[model samples]
Target: MATTETAPRRPLDAGPPPLVADPAALRAVLDGPHAAVRDEVRDRLADQSAILDESADLTRAELRERVRDLVVEFGAQGHAALGFPPEVGGGGDIGASVAAFETLGYGDLSVLVKSGVQFGLFGGAVLQLGTRRHHDAYLADIVAGRLLGCFAMTETGHGSNVQELRTVARYDAGTDEIVVTTPDDSARKDYIGGAARDGELAVVFAQLEVAGERHGVHAVLVPIRADGEVLPGVRVEDCGAKIGLEGVDNGRLWFDDVRVPRGNLLDRFAEIGDDGAYRSSIDNPDRRFFTMLGTLVQGRVSVGGAGLSASKVALEIAVRYGLRRRQFEAGTPGEETLLLDYGMHQRRLLPLLARTYALSCAQQEVTRQLHEVFSQDTPDADERARRSLESRAAGTKAVLTWHASETIQECREACGGAGYLSANRFAALKADTDVFTTFEGDNHVLLQLVAKGLLTDYSSEFEDLDQFGMVRFVTGLAVETVIERTAAHQLFERIRDVLPGGRDGWDQEAGLLDPDYQLAMLRFREEHQLAGAARRLKAGVDAGTPSGQVFREVQDHVITAARSHVERLVLESFVARVRALPASPTRDVLTALSDLYALSTIEADRGWFLEHGRLSAPRSKAITREVSALLRRVRPVAGELVAAFGIPPEALGAHDLVGPPPADISG
Candidate 1:
């Protein structure tokens, strides 16, 4: 975890040109193709700015109602229809919808969570999992906020293992109905958003049975509440106050033989016919289950985008405050220095600023892929493409959310005690985003999924998610651990192919700042880790070691390989984004930031690089020096970098945290 020192070993390089960049140009790049959506959301948030300030003062019940009201307002305004199909009264722009969701992160996170629950998760489930009949019956009302709902998939006994969920939906041929029931307390749906108070219906995932044949898990619509009353045969309980997101009505639910018409089943992927036989086009239960879940990958993509936006909010607040707040004097006699003037403070916040930019590029790419996959006519043919998208989404979500948690906490510490105060916003930012790492999918499990996909090269249908299947599959493969190139691959290849004498030239200090060099180092680590993990699995399997024990032994390696792969993708995305910008101070500034992000990440993991023989002892230390030097170059533009996030002043109230302005030190 050691990072660059505040003081560098040598004099600072002049680095990029002066800080003459336009914040608008930088904002446009960060906003990607959906710049209009971001701007619209910002304007909407500005009009309701008071909620961001007043949320902390409201009681739990009051806050819940306030968030609910705002969601309804958004729905009534047609904002919630952005992600749905055009035929269903929607704007039919999937990427724009995600962009809007990301912008929502600037406001109260409780409201963000509630909005995500309704539009992103619950509504997404109905749209993606349900067939034409189901969509016609529910889509318009759901989009208009007339029909509230919950995506009740996770049970107490089974969350990550969705295939093993115990809740059951049995089709009764005699009654022509589907009976849903929670077989045990553990089978009860827990942590269901909107279940405690507002949800009128639940899209419940349960094992489907017809004529003694079980057809894996499928979604069935069951009424949970009516006329503000808990419906018959359904039980609900409040999850009470938590560390954060108090505005979201998280709850638990139990169903006691709840019956609905057979047509209530979301039969897009599977169905029961008039003959009372379970049927699905996908023969394998595992393939069908994954396909069903893959359709809902938008939830993961939205969470990652929201997490990135939160990081932007935190960085903007901390950087601006650092620019204004001053402490002990260092340069002038009796003149207090700005907090950002010190090398230590710059090292702390500037690199994080750089990383936020990198993640913005990656998030935009993921959102673009999400839109492409969902907009197609034959979405089922999108199986391979969807799997790839899902893998990247999973990896990106893990990294982005983890970065949000880390960046917010660091920003809080950088601002000193003022950040701890309720009015400053860090407390809320930290508390609300802490659960992001686990909610959509646990970070560890998600990363392992990314690694698993990489290992199989997406050849298998992902029939077995267990450790045994992973080791067995890996051992069976003729492993190809090649590094996939980024969109800027040719340029990277030119730089790499021209390097003098490979390792000898790679060890030079100048190469430390090169984009190609940074990418090579990251790719090298990822490829090495992946190959090593494959070898270890093969070894264990060859020796007839139990699959569980073999997997446990290599679990750390598996996760590391996944993390390394994601870091490489993030850097590549940043580089490609920079290449897209025209030659100007804006491009120069972004290039410098891309360098900082790459080097800082390399520096943080220097030990791993060193242990793997990828970096010589002296070369490893040079990366630290390069990071410190980049920090000095970036220090002048720290304020400008954060401002480009274009967060409305009303949304980031931390301007009030610095008290009165102190003496300027930049001059």
Candidate 2:
């Protein structure tokens, strides 16, 4: 049999270099390789036309109304119970629940989040952490939406620190009851969804004391109200009016010696026996705490998906506005230039577009990992399961929430004064998303958790090394750090010596710009952060401090390192994605996008480079010039880039038609 020979696959070509590079030089690299992952995402998006369209037109008020309707509809249809076990009328696939839930992000973040709270948060907590008995008795009503519930873990005093919460659940063995009380004003469960008016049940988190031994934090099912009346000893207070998400009715709850049956305790992870004895499958207190927390990782994953959706919306709005809105018209009378034609505008927006793209890829990876762990087919080891969940939760949560905030703000600025208008959507989107940074674990605190995980990994590696091996490892790290710092300093100095002054200087240096310089600079920052952390750890050891406190201090440094690492990874991913595209008129535009992303990152962290002697003043100037140049080069393709987001016209809805075409010159 004769075998057919095939041509080698070529990467997608990004079109012409922005005014900065020689067209010949640009053409040479046009046939570079493409990432299969991008194609998969593109194809996935292609199949979801209707969902994307609905996502685009979704507004805050409409979202609120529709969400309320969904709550009622799901309740009536019993659709809310889809993710639970078969015995309790659920599909028994938690991964499917998350997958379907993530798709809702394409609709509107507010709607997705509210739905998440109803199904994933409120209903999910009861299903996963609650016992089979609890599921049979209370899960049905909660899932059907007959009873709205809230996951009450956060308090005014202790936000990310769940263990420090003051809500107490003292078991009264004589009465066969537990008194759940919020001891002080700060201890009240604050900012709980469904607490204000809708919720009839709450998975209240509080310190559990069985036979006088405090058992850290545990979940208990509490009846908050019946028939619109607050239950005895339960106080419900509305957290009225906020910067954003006003429709969801977030509120505070105070428990004053609230008497709940001992059986109401959702003790799947940590149990309290009928005889007032506390027992747990997890021996380590810390492990138990994390395992319980990990069960709720779905919220973080959903938040990430939501954040990515929001970023897409913002980018679409800004890019559309850029293509339509006119600015300086040089020679033609009454003929305004498209906002995107301006180099500055591209500089401001395109990299954020790149970031949104990168974040989407990361979110998909996180979702996949989450699905794997939750999948029944996979052999689940307890430790590996916890790490997988925690890693996805912490990493994606930090990345996506931060991306939402930054991208929204950038999109707002991209649209200029119009972006400030409420009707334009930027301002409202920003306000609504602002809370995302703190919710589902504050970004800083979440980063700290990520940092702790890294330290643990590092410590484990440290344990395997002998004394000489340890010394060699430290030496290798130091050498790499020194070499990176030196190389950066030299490159920056060389660029400064060659490049001219002012805008003209920037234009010339732009041609000489190498993307690798930025990557190198970032690497230096990572090394610096790592070295600083090591120094701190050493100091703590010398002081003979408690291991736990020492670990916490080291963890803070690790968070800084992790952030740097994440940023670097994003830049690398963006470049890799760009390199994989097929050659077309749009290829050069994509390359410019890659450049814009890399340079913007460097520009954003100019201080790091400057502080570590990685970048000289001249090279920094070149970075600004090159980024602006790339932005201008990619301007004409902004529409195509947003279009490639593959959002359906329905999701874009009226917003898709709100603006005129870029080529429409009737002024």
Candidate 3:
């Protein structure tokens, strides 16, 4: 039902005019019908900004006072408890929690990460994986901020390699207790929030050893502090000054054979009996490990949401600055051009703007899927639930976290030199966001996990395809890949064949940009991923490698393939949304955004298309030209696009460039 459309004939000297769309229109596209939610988040952010402004130059004690003041406000309003269980004193909706937390992006990254450590990480781990007993015992105090909690998972030596952690929880049957200990300095829990100050309890993760057989990682409740003093056998040391998030007292925690009741274990998947015996509902150790890890996928989802917010803030600052900042004059005498008017500037920022939108849409989809699994029962079996959760968790976490890092850096650069200044927020945001890539599992490692999941799915779903079916799928894939590689060449060739083009022919060719072509290009990328995976797997097989090593190699290929597939899917979703819109200036703006996304992807991976003989040299050139042109068109809408993310001034704090008028300077 779908087919590629070629550009129409055109005259030599004419091309499509540059795009222009206002900030308000861009905001409408991002907020959609969820304007009220955006507004609420904006108001909260504004309040936070006010606090930052008030304490801009305070002492360490004064700063802590300000942080405590803000924490009190956040605690009193129950804003920090958005994503917890309703039964355990939470909002009961993961989506709502993420949405509200994202607004925190407009404020300080330090505040956002600190708050995330409290609610999303510490509180979330317990609520998602712990039983009702654990919930009743600890969730209320955590939610109310009466007892701050820290998530102790990452050790000094083992970061992404969580399965190899050295921290141990050996059950002591004589005392009906579990002896939790740090075997060496490398085994100490490093970089734990709330551990340095404020936290009374910790959700400690360690190797579960019962009856002498070691099980995989599991979580347990360990009290590290009470009555404003450190508990016996626990050593907490400040992490000291860092790049950013100074307000958070992130620190290292060492447990010196601390003993707690065996019941302290938060066992939803794996448990310890009264006699110090270990039992698990899961049979497969690997599956059980993933099941436990998947329970905490909310951290990734929240990070994604937070990343989007960070990108949005950076864009807002850049766009606002771009609109007001002037540079060399062009087109009109003595009138300096807006920074956004420069093609190079647009090239740097507009495509990223489109990407932010794509990321936002993808984030919402991930959040929605998470809510479905957590809140409602699906028709599939329990194993299916586990697999689905694992896949989504891996995919979303990989995509969103990477996007956040990339987008923030791009935004920082886009703001020219001002972006690097601490006063501008970019530098601070960059510092705080740097650890996101490493935390909640490293980006590359998470992507490999997604890859493994994809391979498993592919083997399960398509391993039995008949020869004819296999042939058809491969043929379809190859054809799509060829088309993508040659799209620019194909467009230019078709146009030149019909009408010897100058600017007019180029303009007509540009009109050939349609939803069907976009869809086809997307399909081509997906096929390329599959083909690449197949090639890698075949290479490994031909080398006579061990099955496990070969499988790992195959997994890396599959994850890269899966990531490409998901990226295309996201672009297609953005294009679909654009097509569904009524014809307007806003629609035109969205169209440019969609094009930027698609073309940039194609540009990034032109090699595959070229090697596969999908495109000719002329077509490749055309793609580059078209991409540059689209960037130029989207430049005018850059400010509007970021503004659509809907962050409020207060949450951004004193660092925000756009804030309310000072009381002393009355209008």
Candidate 4:
């Protein structure tokens, strides 16, 4: 018979800690290095009447127009120019740009997506992928929003597999022009933001052909609209009324041999010369393709940060509601207990809060890493470093977006009937963030890409290979099965010494709370999952299994390894932030929250731990109790924790649900 065992609960009278964290201190920590940018965005959102007003009453056309105007307004204010270099009339601060975009997630997501399309995707392509000629002519206009554009990369048949896109850009030597063609129906660019309306041009991804030979995929600047009219040889169809994000105009596009000057090619990595000869600094086509794509890493990083911000907004709403919305009279006479005081409610919301904090720390780290990589005089020269950045960006985007989807839905449920009401903002939040999981790159595919990078150790040739080829490569490849300890080795070692038998030692509450122990558990799981995946691939290949079959069978394991790797990275990032803080009530509170996040992550995957012998049944049970205890410790300060997110009340758009501000229960 199947059975469930509940951990013994601590008494309700246990209460909260003596010192509660100051909301301002926590806000400083969460705001991270680009606090000024976040604050600026908050200030802007507070005054945006169209966005702050009741959007439900607006028609789709009204919503789209409002969002469009907002994007143009933001661009005029230099918000869109933050990521580009100053030579093109930009602020030349990559981190600040991403921070601003991320902060925008607190307001209407339609505005966020529309801005991303114009600035991050379209302008970014021109800045990063195009050389001096293209930039000198178009970039200033792009940043100013005078020349709106779309990143026309995904085809009807190829979404993530850009290398396989069927659209072609054939160099016409006689006319000194490039003919861009959608070879078939499948080659049509689909779900392109700004394509249905408003875009005057597109940075089109097409297979570049010169002298009857292909040079892989390359981006070309093709004009799609002129004088408010669709250009010759161009066709567009509106993808009207989507599941959400109606404020952004998404549509499909087709090119029937559209011709543009040969000089319109991006040409940063690969290009066609005046004599119709294909030229590139990178000889390998695969490397060239990915290198070109890698320059857009900011898109992934910004999307991840934006997704995490959405999670923050959702958590804040749920947490604030949980603090004031009282239920059955379980405590004093005639007075109902606060919803957050209940064990189940705390279990539901606090762990999510801890995770939101953890991911926020991780987002800060990734953003910093991105700034370092792109700020270099020449960012793409270091191939391995570039690939590493790409891998981390992919993993972070996948995990953060998936987390956003889960957290928003859970928050909606936690608020119960109030959340179900459209005016509370959960409906829009839930609908809008649903696409984040599949944006930039689909979570499943992105995770698999992460796993591939791990198995191959970020090998330069790995991106050159397809799925079957990847399986073949991993079969004979030597793999790293051990966890590489971070710079804090001594701290980790001390924690290990506490458990006499090194991980096998029965159990202790202090040990479980140790950051080192939490990291060790997460690291073990990641390493074990990765090693197991490698062994499975080797066995399948050695037994003469077909390469495709072998890969198909092990795909799930590969994704699991990738997810484990990302989860560990998130935890390590959180622990590092907590370690850096000076001793204070804020630090103490964050430490407990970090511990809760770690334990909760482990508890969720305890079955896997027990199967792998890293944890016993009773030890797993102890983790449950510790998580509950941590929840109670965090519950009283829950309001302050959410307050630190610094989301403007106007942006929250749920004033009715969150009625009057309650007194701080932390005291």
Q: lDDT tens digits, residues 118-223, model 4?
A: 9999999988899998889999998888888899999889998989999999998999999999989899999999999889999999999998999999999999
Task: Write out the backbone clash pairs for model 1.
Answer: none
- How does model 2 score by TM-score? 0.77
The residue-by-residue lDDT of candidate 3 on 1-667, one tens digit each, is: 3222222323426766555666577676666444555567677767567545544476655665566556656656777776777776787766777777776767776677778888888888877678889889888877777767899999999988777889999888888899999999999999998888877889999998887888988888899999979999999998987776777778899999999988889888888886567889877775577667767777877776777777777776766666666788876899887777777777777777778777666666676767767676421245556556555566666676677678778767767777776677776677777777776777777666554444344333332232223232333344345335435345544444443344344334343354445555556656566656655555555576554565565565556666776686677667766766666667777777777787777777778767766455676777788888777666655555655666665454324444442232101
Question: What is the lDDT of every predicted structure here?
Answer: 0.86, 0.66, 0.69, 0.86
lDDT of 2 at 451: 48
The segments of candidate 2 whose C-alpha lies over 4 angstroms from its true place after superposition are: 1-66, 74-103, 106-109, 376-385, 458-524, 540-558, 572-595, 610-626, 646-657, 660-667
Scored by Cα lDDT, where does model 1 land? 0.86
Q: Give all TM-scores, in the order shown.
A: 0.94, 0.77, 0.84, 0.95
What lDDT, from 0 to 1, does candidate 3 have?
0.69
Please state every model's RMSD to the true fold in angstroms.
4.6, 8.2, 6.6, 5.4
